[model samples]
Target: MQQAPAKDRIQLVDALRGFALLGIFLANILIFSGWEFLTDAGRAALADASAIDWQHRFHKFFVDGKFYTLFSMLFGAGFALQLERLTQRGADGLRIYRRRVLILLGIGLVHQWLIWDGDILVLYALMGLILPAFHRLSDRALLAWSALLIFAVPIAGVLTVNAAGWPPDAGLLALSERVAVALGAVNPQDGVTWLRRTDFDGWFSWVMSGPIYSWGIRLMSWRIFKVLGIMLLGMWIGRRVASGSLLNDRRLLWRVLAGGLLIGVPANVAYTYGKQWQTDWPSLIGTVPLALAYAAAFALAWPRAQRVLGIFSFPGRMALTNYLTQSIICILVFYGFGLGQVGYWPPAAFYTFALAVFLVQLLLSRWWLRHHAQGPMEALWRRGTYSGRVTRAAAPG
Candidate 1:
């Protein structure tokens, strides 16, 4: 595997990644803290119900669906950068890229089975397989295809399901029943109960059994298309970055930032309220714009706020490690076998806790990079990609 030298690393991208990680942690903590599992009645029963209600609204509007999109785009950008470098070296880029992706898939599987059920790496790896096909497409073509996947497909599916009353087959229902049985839960309530009361063994068993069925459902629902579309957009951005146009184009950045905010803010508000009301259209339509706006805002601020934003680059540089570490830490904190503090804290407390955890991670990441070139998981990924012949590139500056 060809690694970018530390000097060549894009600090802005790393910072954006680091920033995305923070957002992801904030978002995931809802599930990790079991706040997501609480029923509307349960939430209403909280002593800080008013605060929780507003906090949740804020989260749904600003946090949910936005950071993951950013991260996916970054993944595509990384793919673009790697493919370009490989081609420049006249190597068999496709073969090497496939090997790298396969390794990532393996890592993702292990993570999903052993760590967190909300893992995105598996989906990223799965979606990544199709990215090579788009590599040869023009930038305009890439954007066009991305918009089709992101907007058209999902909208069509929603319309079809609503209009035709799509039904779950008996086999799918049986599989879900089997999954629940495997996790020692017979229904949604039982599942939440099991999640709250189970020991390490039971929890591990749930992780092993649940994600399989969950992934199947996601696939059936066509979530992969949205993810793929975002990745393609990332690839387009990466190409611009590689060409040195995106970094220098202040006017373009301003336009993107302005447009993203103007459109994204209201759309996300609609998405938030729509979700509360169980409407799907706003979320499907709003996620990409808000996510893009966030990216544009970050890019515009990076140059002026380097001293502050640059701190994020440490965690961003070892994002794989940080991401996995977050799952492990959250599991330990919230799962029954550990602290078992799930569903106890208010939304505000969880937000503070997420920030605290990320701060610690930032420090740990900085320290680890001082001695090693990359995070442990990244090292393992590189080794697997290179068939045990990995080179130790210097850490990002």
Candidate 2:
């Protein structure tokens, strides 16, 4: 299939991606600034403890799981777009898609290993591998599978674990410890201390060894199912877009927005403040609904706010470059190898910093796209995906 010309590109999707990137950065900055590692006592001692508390609450309610869900959905939607175009042309869609996913996997590995441990690219790449299997399913079947994977699997896992009174598996804990030692830490705390105080080498070790433990925990927690489920939902949305129903149906958008507000908001409130639940499952349950609400709201507003909201499309167009760039910049800003401002800034300061960085990125993206067809990383990814057969066409979101 030929690449979609610029005029045919979906600017709203790009704008939504840009919006998701901003939220992801805000969520990730907690870890990037090293504030996530602070002890209760350490946090209590901060001058802005009350403000930080409020910020954390805000994040739990609005930011934490929501943006990633949106991003995952977007990824799925993009996949649906590619599959539709390729199938129409009778191309080897599966082979090309697998190759594309592998390229993404390679990029994610580099980002995860050398830059930061909070990388989602690796997870997305792995999840993307499974999407092709569901491409031929009916829309109803796709949504059924999505709901089952997103809500049912994670809830069941949580219930099973709670019933069994089990902790994280011992072998996984042992592997984590070994990974710590490989990073020159005597213990987990030592690893944290080393990361904050040591130079580039120490930072490198921490990031390089991170995935072993992180992925292990993620699997044990059934996060993959959640991610895969969200992608499937996105795929359904993509199909809607392809059929011209997504944007044309104002009634559907309104219903989704109403559901998100009535259901999503209250669920997230309980997830954020209800201590009796004693589990994060509420957040998981609420994430998709709220994310859908956000998307619906954005879509409803897009026609009226096209000029203003269109600013986000710049960064959205080159989401990969912007995402990786955020990681690299934040690493230098907070890590010991650069400014070493980790754990020093209050929550407000970090939020401000994140916004400032995003603004810069937005401007840079606008300028870059004016000169080049895509962001540097996007160009590289497209080249790799098409193996030089396609040139100067819009890649999927």
Candidate 3:
């Protein structure tokens, strides 16, 4: 809710966030549409197998988990930046952050239950608590821990999933299945009525299955390791940015750009074609490097591309509002309560929808920012964050 002056604002960060929002939409629409439910034959019939398969490769290479990685990094950077302001003002950053996280947790739960199951806010809120622990660490020590956290668990998980579909123990598998079954199955009859045709019964089915389908399979499956690590890495980068080490070193940026392209490209290519055991696991881990490549590429280009890419600052500025609105728009478009066209659209067509929606959001954001300083959700979050805090003059001398 606190607005920075235009001159002081970091346009590149906003641009990166805006870019990531678009990418997140592209990455997420697949699951939201229930597209995975399509039969192999059904998918083939919808489009030429080669064309559809190529689309899959395109997603894997450029889209897939990359945006979320960028988003998470930005989250860490934002937190670090806020801590600096809080420090200068002699405010307790941890206390303010705790309130902010709580507010986010409440909003995230509401979002998850009503709009979309693929919510990251709840997880971010949970992980934000852990960040204070790192705030006092030396830069080198922080980076070391960040690297270990980001790569170790995910790599191990991938290897485990590749060798055996994770939780390799028969007893554990059976227990998890029992828990999942107890939660319920996502038997939506078909993709058409899954959201549209559902009366109370249909709604109830999804609600019940949320634990298994949404939380268990979605969160516990792999996202935890990925999210936690990326956040830590983001925080580490945040510190560097705070100290001016990251932005000042063009050589470092070049190294990252080169490494991201040189290393990330082939890793993504392998990820696209390889099966679960061979390349799938590695691909998941590779998303981070590729995402970094994207950030570096954009940062390098932003100076030249400002007018063209600067447009991203709109949606990026009101990210939370826009993010939630995306789910609302999607629900209205694809669910039975609305249009119910969920899986009816092909991949290319879905991409068009995402782009169109984002464009509209951009225009709306522009209009809103012209009238008001903060997005509605952001305003509420800020109020909560600063609630009951003593004013500077009121503090002890």
- TM-score of candidate 1 on Cα atoms, chains taken together: 0.91
Where is model 3 poorest over a 10-residue stretch in terms of lDDT?
388-397
Please provide TM-scores, in order, for all candidate models, with all chains considered together. 0.91, 0.92, 0.88
* Clashing residue pairs, backbone N/CA/C < 3 A, model 3: 195-336, 196-336
Error of 1 at 282 (Å): 1.8
State the TM-score for model 2. Answer: 0.92
Give the alpha carbon lDDT tens digit for every residue of 35-71 in model 1.
Answer: 8778776766664657965886888788878898899
Error of 1 at 234 (Å): 0.8
lDDT of 1 at 118: 75
Global lDDT scores for all candidate models: 0.79, 0.82, 0.72
lDDT-superior candidate, 1 or 3: 1
Best-matching candidate per lDDT? 2
Ranking by lDDT: 2, 1, 3
**Residue 4 lDDT in model 3?**
32
Residue 272 error, candidate 3, Å: 1.1
Model 1 segments beyond 4 Å from truth? 1-9, 167-174, 216-221, 277-279, 388-397
Question: In candidate 1, which residue pairs get closer than 3 Å at backbone N, Cα or C atoms, i.e. clash?
Answer: none
